[model samples]
Target: MEMPKEFESFAEARKNNFLNVKAAKDAGKKVVGTYCTYTPWEIIDAAGAMPISVCSVSDETVEDAEKHLPKNLCPLIKASYGFAITDKCPFIYFADMIVGETTCDGKKKMYELLGEIKNVHVMQLPHRQNDPVALSLWKGEMIKLKEKLEKDFGVVITEEAIKKSIKVKNEQRNLLKEIYSLSKLDPPPISGYEMHKIFDATNFVVDVEAKNNELREMISGLQEVAATGNSPVSKDSKRILITGCPSGGVAEKVVKTVEEVGGVVVCFENCSGIKEKCVNVDETKDVYDALAEKYLSIPCSVMSPNTGRMELLDELIEEYKVDGVIDITLQACHTYAVESFSVKKVCNENKVGFMNLETNYSSSDVGQVRTRLEAFIEML
Candidate 1:
């Protein structure tokens, strides 16, 4: 169940292991609330402020939310309302404005909940994702958000500011991408679960440059050792292609499980993993177009007419040279989970060996998971 000594140990957030608004209060960091898909929050951090990704899932009943929010709102909304109903989230409440982006059903309702709160400004994103016009409007919204920050927090947003931020953020994104590429190796230099930790902690840690530099060195060192082929998988490893929902967990876990079962993960087919590299952004064409292009090209859980997912699966088989596929479904994530059967049917027709794994908050079913994975690897 444990990884090699070279890999970092994983830990979850403890009650006092984090800041309860005190970090922002003490640092005089202006807090801003942003619902799902506000990649701009990274921009906000780059602009010299703290952008809190409002998880808001800290409560029970969705009562107080009924006023502005609809009755049948998504879990994320109900959870956010649950937070407000249970206790005052000073971080979000203290925030002067809230930015909402186009993500899914859960995030849309978040905008309505913000209306019920006093002194909370709201920015609405477009329904279509990665659309050229929508991206422009969002960028415009960011401009307005900057204007507001200047007025309220006295922080001026300049071209030099956003452009510099884009570089830093892009560096982080690219570094993560490189880390993902490493998983293609046998016994992979890393695991899918390990990759999740890096992605999740990406925003939590303080020193981005130091951490990234450390990771680059570690991976590079491993690659060097691996240059002569010192990998986990030997000649007996089975290579699998993975496609599923945003592994809210890490993509490395799946890769690791494959290795554990005497298999290898040649490539990933999900958004947070290998799916990201498929996007080649040409910022020179237009910032909005480039941004939209980045998102549009990725293989996502949902697609219109439903051909994208199939195409991605087919290509993954050829590209990764994998023997099978693993589809990860988040607990109660209806949109992604509902499509699982259809995806499985396609995989079967195409003669691709695949399996669906369901999970909750805790990836604690290690024994059961390992058994299932081993069986799949054996079948492949």
Candidate 2:
């Protein structure tokens, strides 16, 4: 089959940008949740609940939260808890509860304070993630989340419903995988920025099957405009790889900027990229078993390095013939952020050119960001 399209269009999503916050205001959906890789946001949305992908830095910018939050905390963490600390958190008042997980050091510390916010609930990812202990714990957490959803939104959490939702998520994943595969082709069918719009729009819109259908049409209609001679596809572009956890726009931006500056982003190994994978459920398997499998196999915040995350990235780099690497991490996501120095040093030692760009919210201080990106590109 011809390559399937990436479902979201930059123009369409921009036009409908107001829908997400509007749905929440209309009491149509209860959550604007923050998720790492593979967190069931689609399932939550499928339940007719409004689920906004959480931006960790909004609290500070919107609620004056930076005053109370430790300055060292990642801006996203500060933003998430900004309302609680400063009393201006719109999400705190609007959300039934902010369902959270202790995915990294900054989040873990921030989670403790959320308990004080009255309506917030937190999920502490197990220390031994992906192993038996974590698998069992996550299943229990899903159950608890189901109960919370029902209680908070009055939507019954049925096994059948979750199963249907899983199917939808899988379909979306398949479509995205196809899009990623297209990126890997001899001549990428589109530009890096064009691909980012697709990724971003998927998060905003609904109806997965229809979304994929749209994507298929777009991809089929696409002309194989080779990457700007700057994409990893064009051996001429500076080959670069990026590593980080729980990134969406940030990861995409890293690739976009690199491509913009004659650097080819050969591989992206963030949690949201390839490390966190979703498993298809067998009809014969029990629902719980299927659920466990889904959680256990997901490359999430904790599933780094150990769960083939590190190995998978290593292979992608070698396979893609990456010429350099970029570490995109949040300041508060201590696990990934603190590891930045190591990531850089190792890349240096390995003689792989690399740079680290830290961010709170993906969009912040464009002028400042432009300078840094330009510097990174010049070095290349």
Global lDDT scores for all candidate models: 0.59, 0.59
Candidate 2's clash total is 11
lDDT of 2 by residue, 1-380 (tens): 11112213223544354444544557555654544543555346545665554444242353365565677766666666664554343334445556677676766666776777656666656656447777788778766766777777777766777677667766776776667556565445655555655665665554566788987777555533443343334545666676775455354455666777776654556654545442454435655566666655655435455444554555666665666787877765666765666566557656777877777553664556667777877776
> What TM-scores do the predictions have?
0.71, 0.77
User: Distance (Å) between predicted and true CA of 182, model 2?
Assistant: 1.4
Worst 10 residues of 1 by lDDT: 1-10
Query: On a 0 to 100 scale, what is the lDDT of residue 75 in model 1?
Result: 40
TM-score of 2: 0.77
Which 10 consecutive residues of model 2 have the lowest summed lDDT? 1-10
List the candidate 1 regions with Cα displacement exceeding 4 Å.
1-25, 33-38, 52-98, 114-152, 232-237, 249-268, 276-289, 292-299, 302-313, 345-350, 362-375
Model 1 Cα shift for residue 291 (angstroms):
3.7
Residue 354 miss distance in model 2 (angstroms):
2.9
